[model samples]
Target: AQSVTQPDIHITVSEGASLELRCNYSYGATPYLFWYVQSPGQGLQLLLKYFSGDTLVQGIKGFEAEFKRSQSSFNLRKPSVHWSDAAEYFCAVGRLGGYNKLIFGAGTRLAVHP
Candidate 1:
């Protein structure tokens, strides 16, 4: 089965520091990669996604991800993280020609420090 793994269960970053969240997936072919952010009591919000085309894709809230097929990874990055960016981030994978279902990772909790 195709699955996603977020190596970091939790991460801490300074308010103005850059952030990078690692994600790896297992699949036979190139699959869709997505980064979703969930605030304290809110539902998941799509931060960014990589379906095809450009390897590097930009997302909302200054988030971006690079799809490295060889590495089977799609890592999310931000230039400078804000305190409000503290949230749970999930990496998801979707099949190209399947139903609208997604396989999600355990999620990486991000903590922002002053």
Candidate 2:
């Protein structure tokens, strides 16, 4: 069974400051990982994903993530934070082969401050 873990329950960052959100996964083999962001009362929107090839992937809204197999981690980073970026972020790992079933972490709530 595959699972994802987001250690940070909540994160607070000031506008224009750099931000990083941690994510870890457990899987038997190379896993398909993804980062998604959700605004209040909205659906989750895909931020980035790592399936194969590049270990470093770019996402929307100036977000990027690096996949480190050794640590079994895929952490999201943003060079500068914005007030509008405040939202709940989710890390997910999808099973290969079959359907689009994704195991998601508990989620990390991001709060932006001035």
Candidate 3:
């Protein structure tokens, strides 16, 4: 079984400030990790994904995440955040092959202050 945990329920950051979102997962094998963001009343969009190779994966909207196998963590980071970056971010873990169900965390809502 695979599961994800996002400890922070909400985070507020000033505009242009750096931000980091934590995510932890439990899985039997090497898991496929993903980060998705959803704006208010909008569908979720894929931010980034890590299947293999590079530990640090770059994502859209100036987002990046590093996979730490030892810690069982994949944390997302942004050097500088803008007001538009405010959204609900979800961390998910899934299997590699075909159609496997993705287990997602509750989600971390980011609030940007001007």
> For each candidate, what is the lDDT?
0.93, 0.94, 0.96
- Give lDDT tens digits, candidate 2, residues 1-114: 688999999999999999999999998776999999999999999999999998999999999999999999999999999999999999999866778788999999999999
Task: Please say which candidate is ahead in TM-score: 1 or 3.
Answer: 3
Best by TM-score: 3
State residue 82's C-alpha deviation in candidate 1, in Å: 0.4
Candidate 3 whole-model C-alpha lDDT, 0 to 1? 0.96
lDDT per residue as tens, model 1, 1-114: 688999999999999999999999997666988999999899999999898899999999999999999899999999999999999999999865658689999999999999
- Clashing residue pairs in candidate 3 are none
lDDT of 3 by residue, 38-102 (tens): 99999989999999999999999999999999999999999999999999999999986787778
TM-score of every prediction relative to native: 0.95, 0.95, 0.96
Model 2, TM vs. native: 0.95
Of 2 and 3, which scores higher on TM-score? 3
Enumerate residue pairs that collide in model 2: none
Ranking by lDDT: 3, 2, 1
